[model samples]
Target: MVAPLKVGIAGLGTVGAEVVRLIEQQARTLSARSGRGVQVVAVTARSKAKKRKLDLRGVAWAKNPLDLANDPGIDCFVELMGGAGEPALSAIEAALKSGKSVVTANKALIAKHGLRLAKLAEKHGGALNYEAAVGAAIPVIKTLREGLAGTSVHRVYGILNGTCNYILTRMEQEGLSFAECLKDAQRLGYAEANPSFDVDGHDTAQKLAILASLAFGTAVAQNAVYVEGISSITPEDLRAAEELGYRVKLLGVAVRTAKGIEQRVHPTMVPKSSSIAQVMGVTNAVTIDGEGIPPITLVGPGAGGAATASAVIADIADVARGIRAKPFGRPVEQLRVTSKAPMERHEGGYYIRLMARDLAGTAATIATRLAEQKISIESIVQRHANGVDTALAKGKSSPVPVILITYATSEDAVYRALEAVQRDKVISGRPQVIRIEKN
Candidate 1:
């Protein structure tokens, strides 16, 4: 009989508990498929006295994660804890050093410190698998690491954050303001109480760093990458984008430019009819670019308790079947970690909103400056402000909100032209420029 591959899981809040449920439900089939049976020997969480539905009667329950990590019977350590530091970090370090395979769904940890941990795991000859980390149950990590290994991937971008996508979709469909859409998402449990991580694009930024590193064979850099949130996205922007045949979606985008790699997370304008533009309401999608094959795209629920656990189990089955692969597609040394292209050199279409005087020559002045920078106007929309144009204006000198879409231009050129327009006496306020990602 094949010996059972013992498992030790930490953080049973949501994902860890789901792991137990999956393992119990699929034990026999997994044994047959893996050529070995799997056993849940131990679990760790903050509270053991709390009620749990699964059967833990025969399994050990540790008050602390370290207990599970150090257990001799545990041949593999599963970390479901959601942070980049603390017990999760310590436990993973302990497990790898103990010569045990480690599986994690912690994208934050992986994005922040993947290369270091990969080196340690390789030194110990134990697998450091995180298929669950990037896209839940999607196996994107494996696809990039193995399936597409033979190809040279040039760019990897995705709509990785569920909350932002949900909110943006709601805004478009219901004509709801950013705040109202966000409130609806919160009420539906699609967003967290503290939604900054998702709404502000930090969550997707982490995932982007991970995916970009895999695609480019480079070390992931989460903090160094530029980040922007969806909070400033307004209903006006949404309506304007729609009228212009565009959709504003919060995208986690990464492109390998000649200058270097450009990584950013922000609300971008994608064609409403494009594949990525149609991925609405909590659904996730990733697009990969490379040489010779059709662009590979995978879309799904990037996060869910059960979906995440499914990826965890797949990694464990690999251990059971004695399968091992590179932590991030290639050897750590061979990974190309280079400086990304400066944003100034990037050329892409843009959406801009500015509060300008409704007087004559104001539009002409704005146009002239953009013209000097070679920015061509594609579309424009004029909307009266709530009070700026009403009770506050002496006459036609009132500042009306003007929104415009521009054809693709270099980032540097746009900023230079904007500087000139901002200083022009004809303009009344600062300009807000949002990149249009028609990728």
Candidate 2:
């Protein structure tokens, strides 16, 4: 019989512990599938005394995670320790340097240091697989890196963060306020206590950076992404979207444009009939638009211990079967450093909501400002102040809610026109602008 593939797991947290359980329970089946027995030989975590559900049995305990990475008895290092800093980074680096294959679910670590790690792994004659990094259990990374390798990918986008998606879904479906929905999400453990990392669009941006690299053959550019969170989304906006035959979703969108790669994360109005708009709750979805094939969308549970562990195990099985591929679908050294397509050059329709003063010619002035920028209005709707607020009706000059949908226009034109409107004081307070995404 062939030697069993020795495994060392660092950070026995939720996903890590589940991985151990699944490996033990499915050992015989995994051996049959991969043609090699996969065994857990060593483990390390922040707390060994912490009560766990799994049986460690004869597994060796390493004092440090790096010890497991450098252990000669271990053939593969599984990194479940998530973070962009210390221990996880150093240990994974050491593992690659020692010619040991690695599997990780850390999106932040991969987004920030993937190219360097890929080069390290290639130099050491070892494999680096991260099927669990992007869209947990959805197989998005594998689909892009291997399954669609022959196609010319034009665009890749998705709802990468479950917390933001959950909040937005509840707000639209239940008419709950952002804060109310966020509180409920926190109670349900869908969002973190702080929630800034997930709610502020940084999490989606990190995942987008990885997907953009895979889709466009560019180096990961997390900083280049224009991030706008879902905090600004109101119940009123959701209602307006529904009325306009659209659904408001926080999307991480990347496309290869003539200017360069356009990467952005923000609240977008997707058509109600689109498959992406139908995905709700904590579920995640990714759409790949490529050449020679219709757009393919992969949707599933984006996060959780079991789902993420399943993806990690898939990567492990591939490594055991001697399936080695470049980390980002291609060699790291060959990945281009493409320029970021300027957001101002982005061409798309927009939904603008304004509080117009109920004075004479208010609508005319607004129209003239937009027309001066050569932006044509597709539709416009106005409601009386009485319908919006009773307090506004009692004021010296009540302000009415005016919503406008514009034709495809440059972002620079919209910004310039809105700025002029603000300077002229034709509208009260800040105007709400949401981009309209046509599927």
Candidate 3:
């Protein structure tokens, strides 16, 4: 029998602890599949004394996670300690430099410094695998790096964050406000106490950056992504989307355009008939548009201890079987620095909801502004506010809610038209503009 692959895990948090339990419980099957037994040789955490469900009878303890990285006995280092800095980054660097295979579920670390780490791993004859970083258990990383290697990918987009998805789903299904649904998400433990990372779209941007690198063979550009959070998404916006045969989802999209690579994370209006619109709750779905094939969509649990651990274990299994692939599908040096397509250059349909004064010529003025920018309107609906918010129904004049759906137009044109409308004082407040993604 071949020698068992020794594993050292850092961070015994939810995902980390679950990984240990999974490895122990499925030892026989994992070994059979990988052609080698996998063993948890060492473990480390901030509070080692914290009571855990898994028995750690035989596993050695490392006082510092960096110790496991350099330990000659350990063949692979599983980094579950997430962060863009400190011990997580330092320890992964040490492991890769020492020629030990490294597996991680750290999206921030990967997004910030993936290319550099991939180069180090290649230099030291080690493998750096992060299948768990993007979509937990979705096999997205593997699919882009291996399955679609031969095809040229044109676009990659998805609902990457489960918290935002859950909130949107609840708001649409239960007719609840954003705040109400956010509170429910917090109570259900789907969102964090802060919730800024997930709700503000940074979480999805980080994941999108990583996916863009893999799909487009470009360097990770987190800063290049145009980010727009779901904090401002109102119940009225959801209703407007539903009325137009669309559903609201916070999506991270990356596309190869003539200008360059366009990456953005924002609230998107997807058609009700699209596959991505059907993915609700805490689930995630990714759709890839590649050459020589129809768009392929993969949907599954985007997060959770078990799902993330399952992806981590798959990377470990590949390491156990001596499978070594380039971290980002291609050699790190070959990954080009693609230019970022400015958001202004983006061309798409838009859903604009505005509170216009119920006065003559106001609607005509707004339409004229849009036409001045060559923005064609697909449909425009004007409705009266009957016992709506006091703010909209202020004084003797009730503000009318005008919803406009425009045909494909440059983002610059839409913004310019909205600016003109705002300057003219035809709109009461900031107009809510949501992009329409037909696919």
Candidate 4:
């Protein structure tokens, strides 16, 4: 008879606690599916005295994460304590070193030390699974690592962060400013007190690095991702997107190019008809474009304790079933080292918003600058100023807003044209540029 797979979990926070409850609740289902019973035998947390509504009658509490990880009775170690360094890192290492399978939901740690940890898992012959780290309950990791194993993937992109997506959704639907939506998100517990990690694109960048590795077979490199935040997005931009048949989303995109894989995170203008654009609120979506297969898009609730616990339990089930796929879909020794693709060389469509001076020569100067850089405009709209003729008749000057949609062009050319336009004194303030991603 197969013995129950004993599990030790570290950090009994929201996700960890839920994982324990689910293991007991789903024991029969898990055993039927995995061909073995799964048990949560040991656990540890920052404060064991902190009362949690969990049943630990048969469960033993360890002194700390390391002690729990090294416990001989457990067959699997689950790490829920999140951080890029310290106890989480050492504990996971110790667990792998002991030839025990490990599961975790720590994206930051995976992005930074994933290659190192993956190597340890390989050397020690134990499974290293982190299905919950990228997208909670989305199954994207398995899709890329296993489902598409026979196919060749060229592009992978998504809306990875819930907080940023919620902010953008509120701004587009209700015409709210970034700050206002952010304040409301914090109040609703969707955002942290220090929201820079999510809003500034770092969180998406980390998740992107992990996906890029799985899709492109490259070593996880968070620094390679070019990051731009949603804080620069404005109501006017969202309104313009609506009129232009597009929606603004904070997207993390990784695609193969002639030069190399390009990974970037920023507020992108996606066609309204695309699958990813339809996603809103705290939901998450990822689109993977393979060589021969049609694009596959996975969408689901990205966060919350229940959603994340679902993914963690799935990883544990894989371990119980004796499945040990490569951590990044490839052996660490075979993973290629990748660096940041230069943004100036990035080629794509661009949306440029300029505040032009309401002078006769301003329009002419702007056109001449763009022409000098060999940029072709797909469309241009000059928003009519309220009572502009009356203001001109009264001998006043105001800046007219001009929006331009450009065909395929280089990032350097766009910046050069905008810089020349700025130097010529034809526009007011800095121009806003958003990249366009087609379906």
Candidate 5:
């Protein structure tokens, strides 16, 4: 009989603890499916004394992550300790170099140093699976890496971060400001105290880099993603988007273009009718558009102990089944180097909200500038002046809100026209711009 796959997990946090529980609880099922039993024989964490409430009766507690990774008794190493550098990286590296399969849920590490670790896994003939790195329990990584291996993918985009999605959802549903929703998210343990990583779009950017690499067979590089946070998104923007038959979502989009793959993360206006826009709350969703196939959208809980653990266990099962596919869906050497796509060259419909001065020729000046840039306006709405109808406030000097939906245009042209409008003193404050992603 084939021996069970002995697993050693580093960092017994929420996810690691849940992984152990699932392995024990699902041993029979895992064996039946994988053709072998899966066991967590060894584990390590920052504080072993901490009461994780997990039953580790026969498990060996290693001294540190490196010790656990290099344990000869273990066949698979799982890293739950998150960070872009240090012990997590070195531990994963050691595990890969030792010819043991490695599983992890660290998106930052995967995005920044994925190519190097993938190379090590390739050279050493070990399976490197990180299905939980991008979307927890969504199976998107597998969909791109194996399921869609035969198909050519044109675009992959999604709402990758749960915290940002929750914030935006509450803001849209409750009509609360971003700050109020963010505080509630933090209180509910959805967002961190600093919250810069999730709110500023860095977390989404990291996840996007990983997905982009898998979809396009490019080397993973977090720096290549153009990131814009959801902090600047206001309730007014959300209202305007609703009126325009769209929903504002913090989306990470990577699509193939004539120039190259354009990867970006920002607050995007997706049509209310689109599958992704229907997703609300802290839920996560990803849409993959491949050649000759209808768009496939995978939606699930993007993060949490149970959700993330499911993906990790699935990856471990793949390792147990002796499935050793290329880490990034292609050989490391074959993976092309990806550079930052210039955002100025991005071509898409734009939703521009300008606080135009309530002057006689303000709208005319704005129209002239946009026309000069050859930007065709799809629709324009002069909403009101401080909640009062523009017509009623005849002599009010206060700025009136002007919302414009422009046809497909270059990002540079939109900015150029907005800059001219600002210089001509036709608007007040910086304009709020959201890219439109159609279904």
Candidate 6:
């Protein structure tokens, strides 16, 4: 019988424990398939004795992850210690330099430094695999590089963050404000103690950057993806979106346009009946439009110990079988860097709410301002206190809320027109705005 493939684990956190669980759970089947057993020989974490449920009786615990990375007995280094830099970065670098296969679940490190690391792995003939980085429980990275190798993907996008998805789902379902949804997500443990990374759209942007790098054969430029959070979304905005036959979702969309790559993470108004809209709660959904692969949509759990470890073990299976590919499906030197589309260059429909005075000529003036900018309104639903337009008929000065859905338009024209009209003294509150995506 062939000798077993030895694996070393770093950072015994939630994911680390899951890795152990998976190794044990799938041991018999994995060994039968590979014709060689895969064993966890050692592990690393900050604590030598953190009372945990994961049985470490047969596994040796290493205080320093770097030592485990450099160990000759370990054929693969599985680094779950997440962070952009530090012991995780150092350990990964050392493992690659030593010509050992490396697997990681750190998107931040991959987003910020993927190009350099990919080059290093190639230089040493080592594999840099991070299927767990982009979408946990979904084999998207592998599906892109291997399954869709023959087809050219024009765009790839999804709701990449589960915390953000949970909050948006709650807001759409309960008509709750962003703050209220966030508090509920916190209690549900979907959100971290500090939710800025997820709620602020940075986490989705990072994952999008990573996917874009692989899809476009370019270095991951997370900073290029425009990010806008949903914190400003009010219950009124949710209701308006619903009335307009749309649902609000935080989308990380990437398109390879003729001009450049357009990557954006923001609150979007998708058609209510669209499949993406139906993906509620902490579930994640990704869509890819290719030349001949037929549009593919994969939806499942975005994060969790079991889901995340499923990705890690998939990569481990690759290592055990010696299956590997270029980190971005092409050599680093051959990768092309595409410029990101400017925000003002974007064209889309929008949901805009304006607070208008219940005075005669105010509606006409606003209509003229919109027409002057060629911003044609598709529908206008005017609201009154008693469901009567009598306040305006009586010439009484009152604040009337006007909800509008505009036709698709150019951003430059919208910016110029809104800038001039928003400064009007009669306009109440900053005009609440959210862009609509028909896809």
After superposition, candidate 6 runs with Cα above 4 Å error:
385-396
**What lDDT score is found at residue 339 in candidate 1?**
65
Error of 1 at 243 (Å): 1.1
RMSD per model, one decimal: 3.0, 2.2, 2.4, 1.8, 1.2, 1.9
Name the 10 consecutive residues with the lowest summed lDDT in model 2.
387-396
Which is better, 2 or 4, measured by lDDT?
A: 4
The lDDT ranking, best first, is 4, 5, 3, 2, 6, 1
> Candidate 5 at 348: error in angstroms?
0.8
Expressed as tens digits, the lDDT of each residue in 150-221 for candidate 1 is 999887888998889989998888888989988888898989888898999899989998998888877888
**lDDT score for residue 358 of model 3:** 65
Query: Stretches of candidate 2 above 4 Å error?
Result: 385-396
Candidates in order, TM-scores: namely 0.94, 0.97, 0.97, 0.98, 0.98, 0.95
Error of 5 at 134 (Å): 0.7
lDDT of 3 by residue, 1-439 (tens): 8999999999999999999999999999999999999999999999988999889998999989899788999999999999998899989999999999999999999999999899998898889999999999999999999999999999999999999999999999888999999999999999999999999999999999999999999999899899999989998888878888999999999998888899999999999999999999999999999999999999999999999999999999999999999999888889889665788999999999998986667868898999999999998877665623332333437568988999999999999999999999978989999999887
Q: Candidate 4 on 327-391: residue-level lDDT in tens?
A: 99988999999999999999989999998877767777888999999999998878656612222
Q: Where does candidate 4 have its weakest 10-residue lDDT segment?
A: 387-396
Residue runs of model 1 more than 4 Å from their true location after superposition:
381-401
Q: For model 2, how does the per-residue alpha-carbon lDDT over 305-350 read when each residue is reduced to its tens digit?
A: 9999999999999989998898998888889896666789999999
RMSD of model 5 against the true structure: 1.2
Which candidate has the highest lDDT of all? 4
Question: What Cα-based lDDT does every candidate model obtain?
Answer: 0.85, 0.91, 0.93, 0.94, 0.93, 0.85
Mind sharing the TM-score for model 4? 0.98
Model 6, 1-439: lDDT tens digits are 7788899999888999999988998999888876789999999998877876987888887769899999988989999989999888889989999999999999999998899889889999888999999879988999888888888889888889999888887887787788888988899899988999899999999999999887877778988899998788877787777877988889998888767889999998989887888898999988888986667888888899999999998888888888768988999999877666798888888887877776667677777778888999988877775544332333556677777788998777677766666665546777877888775
Task: Give every collision pair in model 3.
Answer: none
Number of backbone collisions per candidate = 2, 0, 0, 0, 0, 0
In model 2, how large is the Cα lDDT of residue 280?
Answer: 97
